[model samples]
Target: MGVIKKIFNKSRPSNEKDGIFFDEMKKLLGFKPIALSHYRRAFTHRSSNKTDAQGNPINYERLEFLGDAMLGSVIAAHLFTEAPTGDEGYLTKMRSKIVSREHLNELGRDLDLISWVESNVAPQHFGENIHGNLFEAFIGAIYLDRGFTYCEKFIHKKVIGPYVDIARLEGKVISYKSLLIEWCQKEKKKFHFEVYEDNGVEGQKYFGVRLKIDGNVIAKARATSKKKSEEKASQRAYFALQEKINIK
Candidate 1:
């Protein structure tokens, strides 16, 4: 137990560094963190694989889980009240679009959250998902340190007030593949995807996809997964055929 405590203490920043972190937190959250440990844990990446005195793993994953729930609950309530005329399905779908991984990642990037991440691994090695995960963990930390009221305020200021627009979001298509497929069906045009392995960089295997519309290759894309490649291809195809799709 004493050894674990010593290890944790050793990993913590110096007094000067602590001051810098405190100022950074105040700037980011608009409030001082009463318990800096919570914020520390929020920024700690699993690449560090830290552990506590009782052999419990210490990282942001648990905090990320909590923040995800809190974010969903707050967003769901906002959607429910803001769009009273929307049916259950409509509200649910809208919430999904708002809190989508892509959107969260964008939010994190805008906040420059990765600069604060404490990780043993190089930032370049981390996936884009890390940005959203860190954002959720940071939100979880806010809820833990400041309670739900302050957390809600932060969400309103950061998420709802700036980014969310009901009319714009209503017309936004979260899934390019879905939109493309729907358009093709309505236009009586055939569409299909040819997927295959196309490993390239990082010694990591990737999937490549070619999107075909009306038996013509419309676009090609590659990603770490088949679905992602297909989605990328679909997005490209959508832009290429946006005029036609929007017309129809």
Candidate 2:
């Protein structure tokens, strides 16, 4: 009898940890999840090295891709309805602003979603981008667990309701670098972002960029990455030439 009981217990699934996860997810999702397995996959990091019976690796990357598509669809629909007068370019720009990676990272951090991640890598080693990736995965999980309606509702409640504002978003610049380049092209002025130096302590290195317009240095900036430094320089150049650019 003891041996039989032991075998039975060993084969049984544990509920204690899953119950805690369910409650936490309920609070975050604003509804009880019908399928917990999907949510579990959402929070799973690639480093966990988990796999399914079919030998397919399980992680949030696939979910993230699906969520990206869902988010684009829903946000595009909302933009279409809200801005009836907007042309294709206008609507696209607005949607981009709303679903920008920076905005997604902010949303994920607001929810403290990183706390639920399952991974072999230490939390401290993760980059800021993980937050946005997790948020997208969470949305993908929602879509799979409850369908499009529930997924749309979650996005509306968490993203569109709280953050999106048409007026504010219109003036928002998704990429100052792009804006600066456009302005320079229109004005028939040549512009360049040159890496001047790389500086910083061992683990933390900063790249310096100089923005030159028509052979004249316009702005100089430094950041952790060359791309970031170039963007910073471009932003500074834009502000400096704001009057000339006539940007609204």
Candidate 3:
């Protein structure tokens, strides 16, 4: 609470704006931001055919990069301070889990980050990474517009406070493909995923699926959400390959 207050130190009386973004900020943050431009850039998708006066793409990609670094640094510092006994490798792995693309995507999606995204591309056409990328970009904007201290505080508030449920995240499987890759490496088995289109009925919708395994179709899944379908297929593939893998 103190962290967030310090970040958005300015207090103001409501003047006019009454929308979800403002409302959400008021409900969650209790203060209207002094700078809306930074927040707008946070959710700006690259697909939007928008550019700055310098002809640079006006999107969140750069912001995402900056945010990613800031996030990693803050998280690493936190882990370093909290886990005094953890070695470098342990810290690296823990940080990876925390700042992972998959995890960030979930955080962004769960927070409805897309709701504020400014884009020319149809929202449905966006890939899964958009959520995570926007999240990172937003963080970067916060850092640049504010400062490291404010950025860290905002992350702890918006990220760690509401979403960093450590126990669940520990047991949560972020990437089935990663697991399958590790398993294959340990088992010395060749594996790959074969993706193909799966056109739906006349009125439904088009979709795709991938068959993955150790030189065999051990798992098959389809979904309107390609990532979900891929993850499902990967999960099946993981189960099939699990027996062959030895955990060192």
Compared with the true structure, what per-residue lDDT tens digits does model 1 show for residues 1-248? 55754544344345897767877887898766656788899989888989999988889999999999999999999999999999999999999999999989867765778898889999888898887888899899999887888788889977886567676589765777888888888888999999755666665557789999878999887666788778778867876785455723
Model 3 is weakest, by summed lDDT over 10 consecutive residues, at: 25-34
Write the candidate numbers in order of decreasing TM-score: 2, 1, 3
TM-score list, all predictions: 0.64, 0.64, 0.59
For model 3, the local distance difference test gives 0.70
Candidate 2 wrongly placed segments (more than 4 Å): 1-14, 172-248
lDDT of 2 by residue, 1-248 (tens): 55753543343235788767777888899977766789999999999999999999899999999999999998999999999999999999999989899989867876778998999999878898998999999999999887898899999988886567686588766777898888778879898888898865666576779999999999887666889778767766766676465653
Give the least accurate 10-residue stretch of model 2, judged by summed lDDT: 4-13
Compared with the true structure, what per-residue lDDT tens digits does model 3 show for residues 1-248? 55755644455424555344555654533335545567777777777767889998787888888999999998888888767887998789888888888879866775667888778778778987877987888788777666788788888876765445333356676777677777768778777666687665654343456664456677776554667667767765665554566432
Candidate 1 stretches greater than 4 Å from native: 1-14, 172-248
Alpha-carbon error at 208 in model 1, in Å?
31
Each model's number of backbone clashes?
Answer: 0, 0, 2
Error of 1 at 162 (Å): 1.4
